[model samples]
Structure formats: structure tokens, C-alpha cells
Target: MKVLITGATGTIGSAILRHCLQEPSITSIVALSRRALPQDISSPKLSTILVSDFANYDAALLSKIASADAAIWAMGTTDANHEVNVIYPHTFFTTFLDARKNSEHRSKRFRYIRINGAFTVSDQDRSLWFFSEPRKLHGMSEARTLELGKQYRDVCQTFVVKPGGVATSGAGVMECAGKLFGDGAVIGAETLGAFVADLVVHGEEEEGAIFNKRMVEKGSALLKGNK
Candidate 1:
């Protein structure tokens, strides 16, 4: 499978990048980011591209990225800033959807997986104790993206992964706490990466929202299977 990944330099994104490279079924990958990836990470199946702006995609660039079989978007803001949270990702989603309309690859399904938070609330009018505004704004992004996917369900499938707390590799303490109090609210970064990579390879029929508990279950199963 050929895949494209954005925000490949981030915490979760980087892990996804590494895992994707390790997937034998993934024959090709494109890493689209604002900056270059780490020098230590290199693979025959991986390619990197730097973008000056997320919202500004020229025809050539859009055409290049639109050819991929799937895209993993990890570019979101902590503050839920309007541009990064909504506009940037939405633009890319629409761009890919539109580009596929006139391309021959329309015969294939395009998978799009976006990283969201476990606390995100899609109901605009819902109440919250803290970070209400930011969650709502992020929710707006999620709702918009999902709506678009619904509209173009014939040719594309979209998924949102909402992880409560992402722990790095060998997060012993975090794992213990999550087992005791998380109720599947937390997951390891490597585990999340494995799940995301599996989605790209075997998620031809999966869609809609994915929660932390589900991801943990799926990811753990995938890691064990690969071993």
C-alpha cells in the first residue's frame, strides 16, 4: 500500500511514521510536513516533502499527494486554533476528495485517518468544566471532516482517532496508571502507530470515529499478530 502522512515530526505522528516504514505491506510512503523529519529515520519505502503552508496547496502539489491510497493527518493545534484545527485539515481533505474526482484512481478507496482528542465534544452547545471552548472548536473540525466523508463515501472513508493520553514507548508508569484508572483512556505511542499502520493496510472497509479503548484493543492485537 502507498500512504501519505502529515505532521510526521510530532509525537504521535513520528511513531506512526516509523511503524508504517516497518510494515511490509506498505510499499511506499510520503511524509508531508512543515519541516524535515529526523535524520535517523530513513527507509527505501519512505519519501519526505516540506510544505510552507497547509492551506495553500498548488495544483501540482495536490495532484502529487492525491495519488496516495491513504492519508494520516496528525496536524492539529493544542489551543484549537481555528486555522490549524479546522481550515488546514479540512482544506486537505477537500483537496484530496476533489482531486480524486477527475483522476483514474477513483476506482480505488481513499482512507483518511485524523488524530483527535478523547475529550472532544461534537455537540456545540454541550457544557464542560474546563477547555470547553477549545474542545468545541476541535469538535467543529471533526464534524466538518466527517460530514465531507459522508458526502463522498463512494470514493473515500474517513476516521477520527480520539486518544485520551498518549504514552511514549516503554511508558511503564503510564501503563500501570491507565490499567488502574484509565479504563482504556491511555495507550502507548508505538501501539497507536501500529494501529494506524494497520488501518492503512487492512482498513479498506473501516470508517467513522475510533476511540482510545478501541484503538488499544486493535493495536495490541495487531502488534501480537505481526510478531
Candidate 2:
């Protein structure tokens, strides 16, 4: 299957890209990033596109993206850029959805997997003054994206993955301790990537949202062929 990945240069995104490259079922990859991917990673199935503007899409980019069967959205930020967290995703989704409507692909549903934080609030009206506004904006972004998914449920299938603090490599002692003591302490980037790739390639049809611990459990089960 052809898959389009955004934010391919980020931590989890890069890991996901690597995992997708290794998956035999994935025939092609369109990685969209602000900069070109590293020179070390090379594959005949992989193509990288430099995207300077997320809010606006040219015909060339839209046509390229329209060919994909699925899209993995991992682009995010901890900063106060509401545009990046909220507007950009909404724009990207609408653009892709429109393109899909015009395409003649055989598949009825276009899968969209979004990477979100564990703390994101689905209810936009819920009050939480303790958290920063920027963080709340992330929640808003999630809510807006889900809304679009519902609006176009007939054509677009959206899945939101909420992972806790992601470790790029081996977890430290404190991180391990947190994992043992806490509910959603942290998860390895490689593990997250593998889990997401599996979902894209082999995930069963069911719910649309997945949390951190459940992500690990389900992903592990899929890897073990128990799912």
C-alpha cells in the first residue's frame, strides 16, 4: 500500500519512517517534511517531499498526496504556535479529503492516523485552567480533527494515537521506574513506530482512538501474532 507520512523528520516520525521502510506490505512511502530526509536512509519505496507551507497546498503536492491509501500525521509542536497545532492539520485534512473525493481509487476508505499527546482533552469546552493555553490548543486540534473525521466518515477513517512521553532510545532508570509505577510513563520511539506501522498494515477494523498502555498492549499482541 502507498502511505504518506508528515513530519517525517521528527522523533516519532523518523522512527515510523524507518519502520514503514522495513514493512513488506508497504510498497511506497511519501514523506513530507520541511527539509529533505537524511542521506543515510535510502530505499526504492521511499520518496521525500519538502513542504514549506502546511496551510497551503499546490496542485503538484496535492496530486502526489492524493495517490496514497493512508496518511500518518506525526507533525506537532510543544511551542505556542496554534497554527501548527490546529490550523495546519485542519487545512491538510480538508485538502487531502477533497483530493480523495476527486481521485478514482478503488479503496472506499482512506486511513488517517494522527499522533497526539496522552493528555489531550477531547471535550473542547471542558475547563482546565492549570494547563497552559498552548497545551489546550493541542487538545483543540485533536477535537477539530476528530470532528472532520466524523464529518467525512464515509470516505475517511481517522485513528488518534495518544502516547505518553516518548523515549528516543533505551529508557533510563527513572523512566523505567516511572513505567513500573505510573500508568503511562513513557514509550520507546521504536516501539511506537512499530506499533503504528503495524496498525497501518495489519490493524483490525474497530475503534478510532487508542491510548498509551493500550497502544503497547495491542502493538505487542500484533507483533506476537495473537491479535
Candidate 3:
């Protein structure tokens, strides 16, 4: 299957890309990023596209997107730039859905796995005390994407994954320890990547959003099943 990945150079995204590369079922990958990947990765199945603007997609980019069977949206920022975190993804779903309508793919459901942070309220309209606006924006983003998925249910299947503190090999010793002992609130980057990749390649049959602990459990099961 052909898979398109955004933010392919970020910690979680790079891990997902790695797993996808190792997966025999995935034949092609399109990596879209604002800048080129940090390291040169030589793989016949992998291709990179440098994008200057997330909101705008040129004809060439559109054509590439149309060819993909699934997409993983792992791009995000902590600066509270709602435009980047929220608006861009919503636009991508709309554009991809439009493109899918024109394409002649055999599968009716186009898989879209959106990587979201934990504690993001799906019901954005509800009030909250701490970090209210940012949480609401994040929730709104998920809600909007799910809305689009519902509107195009015949052609689109969206999955929102909410992972807590992500620990990576590159993290400092203290940070890694904190994440490891975070008690179900944290997950390793590799683990998250493998889980998301499995969902993209094998497809997650369960509908709606998935939380961190569930992700870990399901991902572990998938790994064992493969072995």
C-alpha cells in the first residue's frame, strides 16, 4: 500500500517512517515536510516532498496525495499556533477527500491517522479551567476532522490517536526516566510509531478516538500477532 506521511522528520513521525519502511506490506511512502529530512535515508520505497506552506498544495502535490491509500498526520507544534496544528490538518482532509473522489482506488475507505496529544477534549464547546483555549483548539481540530470523515464516510475513515508523554532514545536520561515512570501517561516514541504504522498498514477496525493506554495495549498485541 502507498502511504503519505506529514512531518516525517519529527520524533514520532520519523519513528513511524522507520516502521513503515520495514513493513513488507507498504510498497511506497511519500514524506512531506517544510524542510528536508535531517538524515539522508536511502530507500527505494521512500520519497520526500519539500513543502513551504501546509495550507497550500500545488498540482504536483495534489497528484501525489491522490495516489496514496492512507495518510498519517504527525505534524504539530507546541507554540500554540492553532493555524498550524488545527487549520492545516482540516484543510488537508478536505483536499485529500476531494482528490480521492476523482481517483479510481479500489478501497472505498481511505485511512487517515491523526496523531493528537492526550487530554485533548473532543467536545470543544465545553469549558475547562487549565490551558482552556489551547485544549479547546485541539479538540476543535479533532472534531472538525471527524466531521469531515462522517461527511465522507463512504470514502474516508479517520482515526485520532492521543498519546501522552512520548519518550524517545534521543531524550536525556532524566527525561526518559520520568516518562518511563509516568504510570500509563507516557509511551516510547518507537512504541507509538509502531502502533500508528500498524494501524496505517493493517487498518484499525474500531471506530472513534483512541487514548494512550489503549494505544499501547493494542500496539503490543499487534506486535505479538506479527511475531
**Could you estimate the TM-score for every candidate?**
0.93, 0.89, 0.87
What range of 10 consecutive residues in model 1 has the weakest lDDT sum? 169-178
Query: Which of the numbered candidates is closest to the native, going by highest lDDT?
Result: 1
List lDDT for all candidates, in order: 0.84, 0.81, 0.79
Which of the two, 2 or 3, has more lDDT?
A: 2
- Top candidate by TM-score: 1
Which pairs, if any, clash in model 1? none
lDDT assessment of candidate 1? 0.84
Stretches of model 2 off by over 4 angstroms after superposition: 122-131, 172-178, 221-227
Pairs clashing within candidate 3: none
TM-score of 1: 0.93
- Residue pairs clashing, model 2: none
| Cand. 3 Cα-lDDT | 0.79
Give one digit per residue, the lDDT tens place, for model 1 in 1-227: 88999888899998999999998888999998888888988998989888898888888887787678999998777786999999999988888778887887888889889998888888999888999988999888888888988998888888988877899856546656777886456888977898888887877355888888777777877777853
List the candidate numbers ranked by lDDT, top first.
1, 2, 3
For each predicted model, how many residue pairs clash, with residues at least 3 apart or on different chains? Answer: 0, 0, 0
TM-score-wise, the better of 2 and 3 is: 2
